[model samples]
Target: MQEPIQNRKIIHVDMDAFYASVEQMDNPELRGKPVAVGGGENRGVVSAASYEARKFGVRSAISGYLAKKNCPDLIFVRPRFERYREISAKIHKIFYDYTDLVEPLSLDEAYLDVTVNKKGNPSATLIAQEIRKRIFDEVGLTASAGISMNKFVAKVASDFNKPNGQKTVNPDEIIDFLEVLPIRKFYGVGKVTTDKMYHLGIFTGKDLKEKSLEFLVKHFGKSGAFYYNVVRGIHNSAVKSERIAKSVGAEHTFDENLTSEVFMMERLESIAATLERRLKKHKIAGKTVTLKIKYSDFTVQTRSKTLIYFIADKSLILDTAKELLYQEKMKDSVRLLGLSLGNLNTEVKKTIVVQLKFDF
Candidate 1:
């Protein structure tokens, strides 16, 4: 059976062609014309392309040479990241005006938990409209908004109406909305995963929902549960407020106790590699390594060492973890081992800005 919808209100706001729009706004001559940020005389890639340029198949991450071929008159402008950040900060201020439960996905996109907003407005849809209006009026940038009961649906709905538009997925319509959603449109379903889904006869959310949890887990590993829940319109992940991350780490429990140091080293290596990827994805480096060891007897021991400099490389993590591992003497059979990197960079999260309310 499906769960009842939580009374949370989420709004995902995405600036339409943020960089390209900023360029057009700053220069009157570029308005309503095909424009892109990044890719000038030098051999570079396009970071952001305007809707006009997109019509000619111009897109971000494509070579400048190819972009020109796609649209002969496509204008390339180098990115001014500092300027973008300045404007992004101004836009963020607007978000803060409404609620503190604002989770910025990027400079151009954010998820707002307006459940307990400062304005005391119970309608997340109205809050979204006001935010979009303020973005256009104060920041001179058009944004698209999506409103729903949770982050996943809200984010997906945001894209349905692009370029200064908004869409709301009411609680009663969420199931219907998700049923028709393409697998590719779901969060974290990249091209590879989508192709895998296609191979498994999961073309849409409905197809995905029909699969057993065991089948999904067998096919997609850890993320299988994520897919299963999301297909049912049941994602419960909350927006997080800004905070400094204390560590980067991953750990796993063994089906059986392991006695061999060699086997334990192998597991640490795998754990270290996973941690490195997480650090890189978050663009963070840490200065401390901690090795957690759990014995079959229910005893847990941790060994940690602070490094001279921040490191996020697999080799560094593995080496540090290995040192921490070998430095300590083993006492009993091992049931679990975890590796963590401490002293990390800044991170952000939060939820329920309007305290997750709606109009009666």
Candidate 2:
């Protein structure tokens, strides 16, 4: 008897060293050479490194000075965000043609839920291959893809293959694939978390599965629940398009939480500045401003106000946040302060042409 295939189908598409690859694609002379995208001076950091540069230990977020030391002849170029964004939109449109269930992780990577696709294709592997081919042919760039029953496996499978490659993980092969996987390869397991896992003799997914939930939680706090689910290849998060903005804000947990109001207000001002910049960048306006306070004991509370009109002004946001902060009846000393801009109007503008098309 033949086993029925599951209806769930997912695809993970990721560009290869996106910024550096885009530059190399535009300039034929840069191909097969060490190239980096970022400022080249003393203080600048490397944003992306070519595969050639990767051989010399150069990587993104590493200081430009260190990157040059790693690869002496590495060519550095400034990022072209506008150009990248234009290309990203085109890539997203291509995914929409296949399926509207697209979740973009960044400008370079996205996840597609193709269980019910426009083409009614049963094979996800073939869909991935076709998408990759279209990207290469139309966009003049290469991409790697992974096809699987779920997002986690699909993401892992995509990385298994290198630049310009595709891979698929069948349901039958899940256990075999996870048995030999390193603990560090798991998502959300950073260096600090990985070190703690190693100390507890958790070197692989199989080892992690052996630990009790209580034990994992004792060490990893809230994230331990996530680790428990991921090890068993279980995740329930859906591919949602209309993702509501849960507290549009900026916050930073200090290396050492301070109690001084002067320094706290200074931090709040910086956060407000950043939020205002992001608002302008996204061309978004909001009607509510919220102030969040987290005390040393981890207890948190928020104070918010609904304003008369949409606002994106820097000074107005900071002043409103400061007023909200003053109104908070504090029961304990503060550890973290955050500012959020909410009630955003993100509705798409309906053009006359678009309306005519809709009428037709």
Residue-wise lDDT of candidate 2 within 1-360, one digit each (tens)?
122233467889998888898889888999999998986876566889998999999999776888999899999989999988988888888999998778888899998887777887777888999999999899988899987766787888888887899898776666677767898887678888999999999999889888888899999998887777666666545565444454467865554566666777788888988888888887888899998888766678889998999888879988888788778556777767788888897774321110001000
- For residue 174, give model 2's deviation from the true position in Å: 1.9
Off by over 4 Å in 2: 1-6, 245-274, 280-313, 316-360
List CA RMSD, all candidates.
Answer: 11.7, 8.7
Query: What is the lDDT for 228 in model 1?
Result: 85
TM-scores, all models, native as reference: 0.72, 0.74
Q: Which stretches in model 1 have alpha-carbon errors above 4 Å?
A: 1-5, 40-42, 243-356
What lDDT does the true structure give each of the candidates?
A: 0.87, 0.80
Q: Give one digit per residue, the lDDT tens place, for model 1 in 6-44.
A: 788889999999999999999999998999898554345
In candidate 2, how many clashes are counted? 0
What does candidate 1 score on TM? 0.72
Model 2: weakest 10-residue lDDT segment is 351-360
Question: Candidate 1 lDDT (Cα, whole model)?
Answer: 0.87
